[model samples]
Target: MAQVLEFKLPDLGEGLTEAEIVRWLVNVGDVVAVDQPVVEVETAKAMVDVPCPYAGVVTARFGEEGSELPVGAPLITVAVGADASGGSSEGSGNVLVGYGTSEAPARRRRVRQAQPAARNGRAEPREVPAAPAAPETPAAPEPARPSDGPVPVISPLVRRLARENGLDLRELTGSGPDGLILRADVEYALRAAAAQHRTAAPAPAPVARPVVGGETRTPLKGVRGAVADKLSRSRSEIPDATCWVDADATELMRARTAMNAAGGPKISLLALLARICTAALARFPELNSTVDQEAREVVRFGHVHLGFAAQTERGLVVPVVRDAHARDAESLTAEFARLTESARTGTLTPAELTGGTFTLNNYGVFGVDGSTPIINHPEAAMLGVGRIIPKPWVHEGELAVRQVVQLSLTFDHRVCDGGTAGGFLRYVADCVEQPAVLLRTL
Candidate 1:
């Protein structure tokens, strides 16, 4: 007898809870090898191809393309053993984040392995637990679930989401495979509660609510939704303040032009600025940190992981330059180019998009002069650079047409005072004003 093993949507890391199915790579009865890409899923971070762990025949596929599945929702069922194609029950040991197919890491398989009868295409429903528990002890007030009964939720992320939102998990009805309470169920409950509350409020609520006629409404999901949620959280949680300074970038441009003219690989202004950011962060390590609100402390980082804002067709994504402090101008240039291309092509990974200690936003690329940037939380600060344009400036005690650029730094005040923030921005501006100043640190 062949054993059919089910594959759930593996946790795509970077704290992502769910993913929308972009495309299905295999159909039912298709023979799949271990670690074969079975489905393409678009998480909040990036597009990823989820691989099947078991080498077998795909017996069944769960959820259609364009359906969003929670982290633990079944993606595909593969029949293994002698009768199956490839005839193997062993996994490739290359499962995605938070998923394991081996006998070890018993907690991961507890949701399925405990119930031997539910191994095939059919996963046992929550009622099965309730049914067996109640008939033995019929005198209990609650039969479906007592305080200690299983909650019918497999994904810890779903549990965490409900806990954080002040929503009770037992109260929510599962709409997922085998009556599993997925993240969608919790989200739906929250939305329903919000809608009901809005309706029950005073008559003035009608004035604020959008009228549903002749309006194009889009559900904020995928990348767009992720951006909205992050930006909103940054605004809501961060006590951010912006400070800007106008500096003569004429020298900075001249240095770049000279470097390019005499170089094998052309250097980008962004790399130079990133170098400057790293240097400045070395001096004012306060900005290179994040606020640990629960601990009531500012967690400062030893190394600078510089994040640069890249606007792509997918939306605005900040791809991080890992260990920016150690990389030279050439390395930084190459890394920035690679990350920008990845961002544009929508191939950037979750690791590339997160763990940024600081962000360098070049709104100047969009032809804007200056902006009060929002701090990319839980980051402590962001450096905003505006367009470098020919403007009349006092140079060598004389009025001259020079490349002028505005530098703005938005910081979490909880980390450092305005003096430290001002010093950091001033150091960055100084580097732009005189590129030679950066050479001492270099």
Candidate 2:
């Protein structure tokens, strides 16, 4: 007789309670092997593909694409032979953030080397002498574990990282007790596997990768959904008024080059622009405020949490550099590097990504000349920096080749008018055009 096995959403690493189903890799009745990719899931921070844990024929699918399912909820059912149950168990698979596998009770397979001694050849159960019980008081609820499955003992950030990287949980050998996998184990496995491929002898020539056709519809969830919604709302709801200006960043670039040569964190144009924008906000505090029509308040922040948009495999995520007004050039560079690294590696938390007072989208890295960028919602303004193209400029009626770049500042018309927004942009341009002026504002 074929045994029916239920597969639930595995606790996608960290303590993620739920996740959006991205796409199913296999269909019902498809024969799946152990550790095969089954479905894709999106957590708050990244997109992850989950692997199957049993060899069987899929019988049912519990959730559809874009639907949010709770961790440990039954996602699918499969039919397997009775003899297949005793096979070598690799891990079930890496949990998507807030997602988990089957809700079956944890298998208690303890190889106890030491236990409480038996009395008179009788195995005695260990007991704890409880403190005097409170009078008929109810027991406080315990904190949530991942699910009915084994409680994965890994950090939330590590779980997110593993999910984003498409790592198989079973392939990673857990160092934790009872063979629980850790983040380091997964990372080490990835590195070691990569090294092995590099050292291995050349095999027979492989066929070229297949070309995919047709429009692929990927699910928008987690950070990508949040980013798309906020930007769309800001564009449709907020009357975004923008102004453009060209600034000579020759001096700024020279100063940065000199500073980086002095054995400090190498500052990028975006980092310098971030610092400049923060200083400019000091003079025009109104641009640093948010509008709340429902609350009848214009929330103004005292400190600048400068948010820079970084593109990742999951989606566009902006990790804020907290207190941008306080950090100097070197410190700001360090913070930007740390935030960007965390964002790329899927280690940044929700708090670090949210609560931005202002945003900066740098298109200069892509070598784009200019663009009219949409503002990030709640915040009044977003600045877009264009590429630093070497162009001839008329200086004192004479043609001179100079480094020139455009700046586009988009702001909510309800909160900031053209004059206010223009002044802020000019101030930032002036600061960038002449980096020495930033010292006084800070």
Candidate 3:
């Protein structure tokens, strides 16, 4: 006999409670091997491939693509034992949080039938009612009402979209199974509302009314949602302050050019800036620490886990470089390139996306001069670098055009005061203005 085993979604770690099914690799009746990836899911952090711990024929699948399922929800059911297409009865030893073969089999729950009341002190056999026969015509579903309680919305992005547009999700009909509201349904409702608004408005004679369309709404889920949640939390919880300085980056640019000209592996400008940041953090260790809200104590870090913000098609992601203080410009350049590629391909792991003492955001690529960046939560500070452009400056008491860049430091006020923040920014600006200033720390 084949023993049907259910495989529930495993914890992806980093406090992720749920994940949306991006695609299913296996279907019903498909033979799968142990530890084989059965589905690809997108969590707030990153895209993950969920592996099945059992090797057997897939009997059923739980959710459809794009449907969000909480951790421990059944993902698929597999049939084990020789009768199940000659599959093995033993499950693979590979372990995930909720799925493993080492644990004892779970006991099935049994339901007891209701007994008839005693009649005249003697038990009388009650007549059992027959099950209702299926009607020839299926009845129509009941109309959704305002008192239907809360709408079934799994994605926070969908809820936010409806809330921002003043659209009541309960009034709209969802195209998903079981009336599960999705981002697309919210967008469609918005478009319909806009069309209705335009039609109701009176138009002046001899004036052409422009058609309102072509609005593209990308759902803030996966990596984008993760970024949004982190930034929002950082703004709400942390007492953050920003300090910026315009530095003559001509020296830094020149130094980078020289290094690349004589280097075995070409160093990147971002890597050079990262090197400067790590050196600055060493001098001002206060900016490289986080506050323990529960303990109400400032937790200082001995090593630097530098996170750099990388923009991708999926959204903005900060991939951390582990022990960045120990890595040189060449090594940092290589690591940054690798991580950036991973971000682009959406292959970065949860480990790469977290555990940073500080962040370096190079928003200069967007062609902006400067921005007061929000600090990455739990991290004390973030160094924002702006575009390096030609600007008039006094060099050696003579007016000259130099490559200048703006450096902004956003620090947590709870961790350090303005004096400490100013000192850190000044050190970084000095390094940018004079690359030789970094040599002292090196």
Candidate 4:
């Protein structure tokens, strides 16, 4: 006899609570090996392939693709022990944060069958059917329920949509397997109600407005939603201030060109800017510190975990470079390239997306001159770099066109005052204007 074991969504760590099912890798009745990826899910941070701990035949799956499930919710049930496939009963040793296989065998519980109701005049307990077993074939669809019974809905979002639109879910039949109510069912009910209202309404007055067409609404629930939430929280929680300066970057550009001409590896301009930011932070450690509201203390980081903003097809993501202060220009450039590639391909893990003490945003790639960036939360500051363009400037008391860039620093006011922020910005601007100043620190 095969003992079936249920697997729930494991905690992906870093305070993530839920994940949306992007795609299912295994189907019911399919054989799977231990530690094999069974499903692909999209969390707020990144896309993850969840692995199954048990090696057996997949008996059932809980949710549909595009459905969001909370952590600890049943994901799938695997029939372990000796079976048709001759698989082992022991679970894999691999472990995620919240789930794993142990050396000890799992204990099984036996359910007691309910007693039948008495036929006599005396009142007796009614018998209740046992829960359905995992089917070898596809799970049977749920039978239609009485009007007074609760609707078969799993997602809270589906219920919320129906409630917000004033549609009663009990009155409609769900299109999903097992007669589970879905968002589409709620939407269909809403559209049918609107059409019925329009048909029954009297002729509209001349002053009445006509219905508009061709408007599409997209839900903000994935990467876009995550970015929005973080930015909004940054604005609300951080008392931020911005300071900017225009610097003649002609020398820095020339130095980069020379380095690439003579060098083993090509260094990126962003990496150069990141190098400068790290050096500036070293001088003004106050700007590198975050405010701990609950502790009522300023927390200063000893090492720099620099985060750089990269815009991808998914949305805007900030991938961090660990120990950036210790990396040289070449190393920083290589790490930046690797991270940017991962960001573009949507392969960045949640670990790559978090744990940063400061951020460097280069919006210049989008053709913008400057922007006051919202600080990445828990980080004290962000350095925004603008496009380096030719501008008329006084060089040696003579008017000439020079390669100039606008640099802006947005800092948390709770961490430092305007004087500290200005000083940090001024030091960064000086480095950009004169690359030799950076050589002193290097």
Worst 10 residues of 2 by lDDT: 106-115
lDDT, candidate 2, equals 0.70
If scored against the real structure, what TM-score would every candidate get?
A: 0.75, 0.60, 0.74, 0.76
Residues 206-285 of candidate 2 have per-residue lDDT tens digits of 33323455344656657776777777888777778889999877778888888778885578767788888888899888
Which of the predicted structures, 2 or 4, would earn the higher TM-score when compared with the native? 4
lDDT of 4 at 346: 69
lDDT of 3 at 216: 45
What lDDT is reached at residue 13 by model 2?
53
Ranking by TM-score: 4, 1, 3, 2
Residue 96 lDDT, candidate 4, scale 0-100: 50
Candidate 3, residues 199-258, lDDT tens digits: the string is 997555222333465344667776777888998999999999999999999989999999
The ten-residue window of minimal lDDT in model 1 covers 104-113
Best of the two (1, 3) by lDDT: 1
lDDT of 4 by residue, 1-442 (tens): 5566777888777777899886677766677778888987878777777888788667667777668989988787776665423567666767653334343147742222213332322113232332444445323235434764456764544654675466777798988888888777888888888788789885663233344653446688878998898999899999999999999999999999999999699999998999999999999998787888899999999999999999976789999999999999999999999999888766687888989999999999999999999999989999999999999999999999999899999999988889999999999989888889998898
Q: Give the lowest summed-lDDT range of ten residues in model 4.
A: 118-127
Taking all chains together, the TM-score of candidate 2 against the true structure is 0.60
Misplaced by over 4 Å in model 3 are: 85-219
Error of 3 at 389 (Å): 0.6
What lDDT does model 3 reach? 0.79
The segments of candidate 2 whose C-alpha lies over 4 angstroms from its true place after superposition are 1-42, 46-67, 70-215
